[model samples]
Target: MAQAITAERGQWYKRLDLDENFEVVAIDRDEECIEIQYYSGEIEEIDEASWELLEIAPIAPPDNWSGAFGSDNRVEFEAQADSLETALNMVDNSN
Candidate 1:
């Protein structure tokens, strides 16, 4: 059965029974087709008949201890800053 879907611009969706995620880049309601961009930078048009509305779970930021660093090394920099702050605080307390 074709799932009933309402495509909205800038919404993320996943294919039924698939792990890949896509964002709705455009919608042509008059033609009943939606343009989607994949996580891999691939873009394609899918007829409304082939897709359904997907409920995506909210993603949480990585905890400080987690090793999942971003491309800019933000996590490592934050860790170093925190350590330096702690050491400076200890020195200040000892004085």
Candidate 2:
């Protein structure tokens, strides 16, 4: 059976088409807005119409929820990614 999609706060979802993941961070009924935080730490507020159009399905929490540091540390995280590659290269050269 296909599981129904619910917009409850803190729920994680995988956008099937984009192959991306995000979480429901907030919902304001008065404003008819839903705030979501992507795994990459991008925040977006969507209205009911937009939310209905999203082709998403509920999913387990990501193994690594680095969205905690969020977009604020995006540059720093990106730098660390480069450092990770450099470390891998060093390991390869040591072989």
Candidate 3:
């Protein structure tokens, strides 16, 4: 019997039966299919039926999202700089 849980994009889930963690990357309702990326960088396409067949539980995102990528791929994401007016507006001159 399929579980009541249905896969949704951007959600993390653990497959209890296989002890594997996967993230739902994309869903195509028109195609009735789902794309999942495993912790080991493996991408698999499964139909909705197959998704429900798995014993999965919703889980918090893993501590390290770079499980699939190598050290070379690890890079810090920098915040974009604000506009000149925005930056000037935040200056403190209450001395």
Candidate 4:
């Protein structure tokens, strides 16, 4: 089974098609460099001075539990995603 990204840091959303194989794309931002894994994964490099650890929930299917306390839980569900590359390409070619 595919793994859900447990954290947001080092992780970014890409709309690349998940069904196809493609070369990795490199992106540079300030002093950080990131590798687009299409729809698979991402690689990011951050300065040690700026690195911080944050707790993140792992991706999981919905449990259908509902209540006052469960309201926030339902919000954490993730939906299906298209290829990250396709989405980025659309933005790049847009006028």
The lDDT per prediction is 0.54, 0.70, 0.68, 0.32
- Cα shift from native, residue 18, model 2 (Å): 1.3
Better of 1 and 3 by TM-score: 3
lDDT of 2: 0.70
| 1-95: candidate 2 lDDT, tens digit per residue | 33446697767898887898987777899999998888887888999668888889998876555454344644555455544334334434546
Per-candidate TM equals 0.48, 0.64, 0.70, 0.23
Q: Write the per-residue lDDT of candidate 1 for residues 1-95, one digit (tens) a residue.
A: 44465666645556644576666666788998888766556788977766554443322222332222222544445555555334334434545
In model 1, pairs of residues that clash are: none
Candidate 3, residues 2-49, lDDT tens digits: the string is 477978766788989889998876789999999998888888999987
Q: How many angstroms is residue 7 displaced in model 4 relative to the true structure, after the best TM-score fit?
A: 9.0
TM-score of 1: 0.48
lDDT of 4 at 1: 25
Which candidate wins on TM-score? 3
Count of steric clashes across candidates, in order: 0, 0, 0, 8
Candidate 4 wrongly placed segments (more than 4 Å):
1-27, 33-51, 57-82
Candidate 4 structure quality by residue, lDDT tens digits, 1-95: 23243223223333223332222234455655434332222333433233223122323212321111122322332222243344335434543
Error of 2 at 52 (Å): 1.1
The candidate with the higher lDDT, 2 or 4, is: 2
Q: How far is candidate 3 from the true structure (C-alpha RMSD, Å)?
A: 11.3
**Which pairs in model 3 have colliding backbones?**
none
